[model samples]
Target: MAQQRDTAEADRTLKAKHRAIWASGDYPSVAAEIIPGLGALLVEACGVKAGDRVLDVAAGTGNAAIPAALAGADVVACDLTPELLEAGRLMADRSGVDLRWREADAEALPFADADFDTVLSCVGVMFAPHHQAAADELVRVCRPGGTIGLLSWTPEGFLGQLLTALKPYAPPPPPGARPAPLWGDPDHVRALLGDRVTDVSAERRTVLVDRFETPEGFRDYFKERYGPVLAVYRAHAEDPERLAALDRDLAELARRHDRAAGSGPTVMEWEYLLLTAHRTDTSP
Candidate 1:
């Protein structure tokens, strides 16, 4: 009981940071920027076809799911966060795509076995507490010979660099904490998936990130948009001085953004690995 509370508290802290980071309309903007490439990669990598039954796990704000639906797939989009799911559904409706939204955890999916022709997640698998179970769950619902497609950001990429820069200013995160894990890393994901899955493959791609007006723009955006993250910060880290320092640091970033204007894009780059695999039937 005590352990659970501790875990919950820790989660709250991280999520607050997430809220602050995404508040500046960057949440949807970045998703919009990346969805086209992510969508095209998903199609090519998984060979998705019209009328396929697709599962989109952690379908944040309908980035991948909307595009997949546009391609004529019947998509079931699921996420752990109801707020994100709500936002995703709204976006889908606005886009005129039919996406079935569900609130569910990626590690323990609520679906029948072999229910989907294809399963996909955009940088979501590693967020599960039990990554192995999550991977298995994804495979379980996918029909034999069906494709499972995913995109995971490399920890060392520009995304990580941005977080690294923020680290010096913000309060420390819990130990062993990373924004998300890259289950697409060959050795790591293979070890997690085990021998049950067949024909597993992965490819690395470069993602161009724009729309961050400046470093401050990025910080302010997150501060407002991500609720869970904001809630955590409000609850914990009762240090006014630290908060003041964060404000100053973000102010400097805002200045940098203004200075870079009329020059060109800030040109932050993120590396992602796209993974594809076939779910093998367990029945003898």
Candidate 2:
């Protein structure tokens, strides 16, 4: 009991900072460019169909939710940051897709138990401070036999490498916080989901990131709009040396992955894991 209380308290403290960091940037601009196809893929992979009640947890700018809605599902887009939720609302309106939007935390979802036919998160819930709590909430909200789909950056992927490169300059997570990349590991995911779900499957998928003239330009573009990258810059506002070192590291990583350095804009493939599982029947 004491450990649970401590963990909950720690999560509360960290969540405030996380909400602020995510809200600090205009993530919609970046999300708009990368999320559509990924969202569509998740929608199809999860078997979301017309009349299904779909919940896109930690949905940034309504990526998955919008597509699900367009497919005739009743979609609700939820996120911790109100700014992102608002961006989702605007984007939904522009897309002529009607969906509900809610500002809610992934670790403690505001919905009732067994409330959704399909629950999805795309590179979103992995950022939750408490992985187990978030995972439990995702399972709890999904109806029996419903589908849960997720996308996460693998530990050996480009995004994972970027996170490792930025670790030195960024603030450490709470003492017991699980590493987010664990979600990308199929075995780890199976352990996390445990017996509560069945038919667990995972696959690797690649999404192409926008091409930039140079690695430095690519780094700069992300720093301006990617929430986590913006947070790192903000954390090092008074330390130019650390910030410069971080920027150099990011640029180097970009250069290392850039295949067409001298030919044309640098297009790179970001590999992520697509996970799908069905909630087990709890009725007895």
**All candidates' lDDT scores?**
0.68, 0.87
Which residue pairs does candidate 2 place in steric collision?
none
Can you write out model 1's per-residue Cα lDDT over 129-215, one digit (the tens) per residue? Answer: 456767788888899888888888666654434444455654655665544545646677777667657898878787665667566
| Structural similarity to truth (TM-score) of each candidate | 0.75, 0.94
What candidate 1 gets wrong by more than 4 Å, as runs, is: 1-30, 33-37, 161-179, 226-240, 244-264
Cα RMSD (Å) per model?
Answer: 4.9, 2.0
Give the best candidate by lDDT. Answer: 2
Model 2 CA RMSD to the hidden true structure, in angstroms: 2.0
lDDT of each residue in 123-213, candidate 2, tens digit only: 8898886778888999999999999999888888888888888888877766768878888888888887789999988998888876578
Candidate 1 scores a C-alpha RMSD against the true structure in Å of: 4.9
Residue 8 deviation, candidate 2, in Å? 4.8
Error of 1 at 134 (Å): 1.0
